[model samples]
Target: MYKYDNYDQQMVDARVSEFRDQVARRIAGTLTEDQFKPLRLKNGLYLQLHAYMLRVAIPYGTLSGAQMRLLGDIADKYDRGYGHFTTRQNIQYNWIKLADTPDILADLAKVEMHAIQTSGNCIRNISSDQFAGAAADEIVDPRPYAELLRQWSSFHPEFDYLPRKFKIAVIASETDRAAMKLHDIGIRLRHDDAGAIVADFYVGGGMGRTPMIAPLIGDGIAIDHMVTYTEAALRVYNRHGRRDNKYKARIKILVHEIGADSYRSQVEAEFAHLQTLELEPPAAELARIQAMFVPPAFDTTAPDSVDRSDPDFAVWLDNNVHAHKQPGYALVTISLKPIGGIPGDASADQIRLMADLAQKHSFDELRVTHAQNIVLPHVKKADLYALWQMLEANGLGTPNLDLITDIIACPGLDYCSLANARSIPLAQKISQRFADQGRQQDLGELKLKISGCINACGHHHAGHIGVLGVDRKGVENYQLSLGGSEGADTSLGQITGPGFSEDGIVDAIEKATEVYLVKRENGERFVDTYRRVGMAPFKEAIYG
Candidate 1:
């Protein structure tokens, strides 16, 4: 994790002070709702359906045990007893009082965290692979570059008020765990034939009403030129991106209007002008940032020594754990989507317990994954049982990681003001429908994501079985999509036949999955089978 220097500390302190005054004025009735809306949004505060929601940035999804403890404290003291971990790896408290926001920001600042850039039409939090440094396939860690971007984009004068919110994701590995292709700007870090680190840039990718997989802009860009290239891309978007309508304001719309080739040319022209400036950081600065991310030391002993006696724990280890770069260690996911429970909601006590477990068993670090789960990226395989026991006791141990029951759902009509229908309850019903462990295992690597509306907050566009909620004549309706994936092979899901009532949606999903199970090849995933056979088979099964 990157520790804040004096400059970072001073900026946060100033922001907190400024927000404290703003809260005072709002409470004193000097500032109306319309007047205070933009101010509060700049600080990551939203007036939700019932109360204010505060979104706190977990930069690049990295957190220390102490930071986690602070977040738990805020959840306990300020708002409800739980927090919602979002797809962007930020956490949102849905029941905050308007007056207590400054205090929450103060608490975050004490732990070197803040809600800055978590919302608004400006550049939002920069996301990287949750397993950035620890993944086995990584060529180089992407966090240093992400941190560099974070510093450059924060409160940038020219780009502060963009046409719409901008999101950027970086992936350093061959496998795309960060959903890099679904971002406004996605950077693929790779090495050239000469073994020098370089970045491949993709711009104009986004998910919303108009989902677009970005087109590749440039390749083999020297690592030192990242800032210059990124600035050039942003300049292009800022100049020509749609401003008249919020619906078409994202960079994706600009790219679609003016073809990718012309956009690339414009960016190149801008980059040519910036080439004369001192855009690259000093080599020493890069080295300094890299040093902070060096992997923790690990024991070389084999990981098989741990007892596999507990069948439940073993199932979790097999399904939820991933191979790490280090020997005898595994990257473990703590599933928040327990059957019949809300996805990505963790109580304060559970958060504290996880913080404790991270300090004791793994390195004193944790990651909030894009799939709405918590990750202990460097847990020794030997500690799996003990960690599982503690997590199970805390209600954080669910062996359904990546299973059909582990659904990714948004805070739909239940919390979000923009939602058309309720998403959490739908996720619960779907999980219950497939609650049998054996049944979910048989389904195999099925991803089910639901969004309350077309904002695509839950990334329904990328799930294997995507459910979308809509308001049909003031009644809640659900639509199903199939064969979507957000991985190395990224593809947007295609909608199935027609919309269904809320009660019929779960059956629709079950029918689709059953069709896949029957027609799938020996070892094909749901996506692979869907791609091979198209939507015809599933459509027949679901609608027949």
Candidate 2:
């Protein structure tokens, strides 16, 4: 994991002190809510429905066990005894007090973490594959590049108040685990014909109201030029992106207004100009960042097999454990979406236990996934059973990876002031409705995502079973969509028809799954089945 140097520590500490005073002034009524809004947002504070919310950035989802333990302490002391890990590799404290935010940030500063840039119109957290260094199929660990971007974009004045929030994702896997196509900017670390790792830039990708899979803007860009290339893309968008309409303000909307070709040309022109200015970092800086992400040493003679005679362990092993590049190591995903539990919510004890597990079973490193799960990226095969025992005791051992019950949901009406309906309760109901572990395993790899609004916080547009909560009249209604994916084969789901009531949507999802099971072929997941037959069968099942 990357350690904070004197410069990094100084910057975060300074920001914490600055925000502490700003918060005090706001509380004293010296600054109006309007005046304090942007200031608070820049520091990742939001006045939610019930209380203030603070979003803390976890750079590229990488953290040491010590850092995670500090997060657990923050969750226990500053706010509620739990925190919600988000899809963008960040975490949220929903019950935060405005007065406590400064202290919370100060604690985070100690751990090389902060809430800065988690909100605001500037670049948000830079995300990468959760299995970055350990994945079997990784071309190169994308974290170093992602971390470099984090340093470059953090508080960058030029992009400080853009048209809207911007996000960037870097993925090194062939399978696109980071939902790369759903970000404002997606960088693919892939090899060219010359067999060198180069970056393929995708521009105008986003998933809010107007969902889009960004078109490729530049192919096989030199790794050294990634930062300058990104600058060019943003400059183009910043110059011509719509400011007239808030709804049409994202880079995706701008790319649509002007054709992808025109957008590409504009970006290239900007890139050419940037090159003339020699804006790209020196080779030494990239090497320094890359050195920070070097893999932990693994004993080559360690046993490669685990005892899976225990039925529960077998289930967990099959679902939660992933292949690693090293011979005797596995990537273990700690499921936060337990059956009937709030998706992504982890108790303070669970967080500390995870930290201990990472320190003991895996290396001292852990990662937060885009699906809102914790990952022990380098756990030894021999320790699987022992780790499982610890996890089961802590209620963190849910064998529901990629299954229907492993839902992704936002804190909708429960916490968010902008939400049209409650998402957590709906997600819980659906999870309970499909509580049969056997049934879920049989169904296989069904991603169900719920968003409280069209902002798509839960990435409902990318789910095989997409549920979007809407305000129909004064009552809450839920819309169902079918056949979406946030993978290598990315696609947006289509709405079946009119939405159903909160309870009705859960039943509607059941009906749609029934249709999928009846129509599916061998090795076909719900997504594949839905794609093969289109939305006709799902519409019939829901509406008939």
Query: C-alpha displacement of 28 in model 2, angstroms?
Result: 3.5
In model 1, which range of ten residues has the least summed lDDT? Answer: 297-306
Scanning candidate 2 in windows of ten residues, the lowest lDDT window is: 1-10
Model 1 residue 167 CA deviation (Å) reads 0.1
Candidate 2's C-alpha runs over 4 A off are none
Q: Please list the C-alpha lDDT of all candidates, in the order they appear.
A: 0.90, 0.91
lDDT of model 2 at position 172: 90
Question: Highest lDDT, which number?
Answer: 2
lDDT of 1 by residue, 1-544 (tens): 7988899999999999999999999999999978888788888999999999999999899999999988888999987788989999999999999888998899899999999988988889999899888899999989988988888888888888889999999889999999998899999989899999999999889888999998898777888889899999999999999999999999999998998999999999999998889876777877888888888877777564568888998888888889888878889999998889999999999898989988987789999998999999999888888899988887888899888988888999999999999999999999899999999899889999999999999899999999999999999999999988997888999999889998899898989988888889999999999999999988998899
Clashes of 2: 0
Q: Residue 43 lDDT in model 2?
A: 89
How many clashing pairs does model 1 include?
Answer: 0
Q: How high is each candidate's TM-score? A: 0.98, 0.99
